[model samples]
Target: MKPIPLQRRPRGKKPLWREYAEALAVALVLALVIRTFVVQAFKIPSESMLETLLVGDHLLASKFAYGIKLPFTDTYLYKGDEPARGDIIIFRYPNDPSVDYIKRIIGVPGDVIEVRDKQLYRNGQPVRESYIRHTDPTGREPLRDNYAPVTVPPGKYFVMGDNRDNSLDSRFWGFVDKSAIKAKAWRIYWSWGGLDDIRWSRIGKKLL
Candidate 1:
């Protein structure tokens, strides 16, 4: 007598809800990874940065530009190059770690910086900042216009907003620790004016 062939069992399909849930979980993980180590989005909420980063502008920052910091901690897993002068960076406010601030790197570690008559001097040489804007051209405050020279401490940076006349920056708050820095501003992804006025021209513009 011939031997009977054995039948194979068909695989069962996953439930629709389960499939959707799996997809959603995957998406969330990917987003978290990107935000933590690759890049992240931020909105400009103040006019301190002005022409360089206008209020209501949505931008992307490169988290890996300087290094990869461990999530929920200031420790870095992979160290990168130090932030260079002129780099626009997002960092934790020194006074309040819960708040984030964006500013341009004016002085890196060990650089001598000063503000004389509202002009920035680095290492005793005048810095010509074409992007610098003054909302009140004639207005002058003692510390705002004439800050005494100071050396940026090791593992720290001196930062200032592009809107020199109105910004409260390193001249007021002191240096930003390297561990507080999060990312470098990469590009403007979106922007809007008062109410419904969308700034179409600023979208996709690269931040200097």
Candidate 2:
């Protein structure tokens, strides 16, 4: 007797729903990785940055500019170059780590910083800050107008906002530690001036 022949069953394709779910999961993972290690989107919430970064401006910050800090931790996987003076950076607020602040690097490690009559002096030389904006011309707050010189300790950065007169910065709080720095502000991706008013001109502008 001949052996009975067996018929093979056809294999069915994967469900469309499963494929879509897998694709969505992959996209979400990629976005999270990018946000944690590469670049992240942030929106300006106050007038602290003013003309440089207006309120309602959405910007992207390069997380790897200084180093790749482990997400939710201060430790870095690979330490990058030190932040340079005048480089705009995003860091955790020294006084309150829960909040984030963006400002220009005014003084780096070992640099002497002082504000004399609203003029900034670094390392005994006057800094030429063409980007600085003064909303109040006659305001003479002691710390705002004439700050006593202080040497920035190692691993700390002295930062200040472009809107000098209105900004509460290193002068008021303290220096930002290197480990607290998260990223560098790269460019303005989107901006809205007011209700239904998109700031087209400010879009794509690079932040210093």
TM-score of each: 0.94, 0.92
Best by lDDT: 1
Writing each residue's lDDT as its tens digit, candidate 2 over 1-208 gives 9999998888898899999999999999999899889999999998887788899999999999888877777777978878999999999998889999999999999999999989999999999988999988887889988999999999999999999998999999999998888899999999997888999998999987
The whole-model lDDT of each prediction reads 0.92, 0.91
The global Cα lDDT (0 to 1) of model 1 is 0.92
Runs in model 1 with CA error above 4 Å?
72-77
- Which ranges in model 2 have alpha carbons more than 4 Å from their true place? 1-9, 72-76
Instruction: Report the lDDT tens digits of candidate 1 across residue range 113-170.
Output: 9988888999999999989998877777887899999999999999999999888899
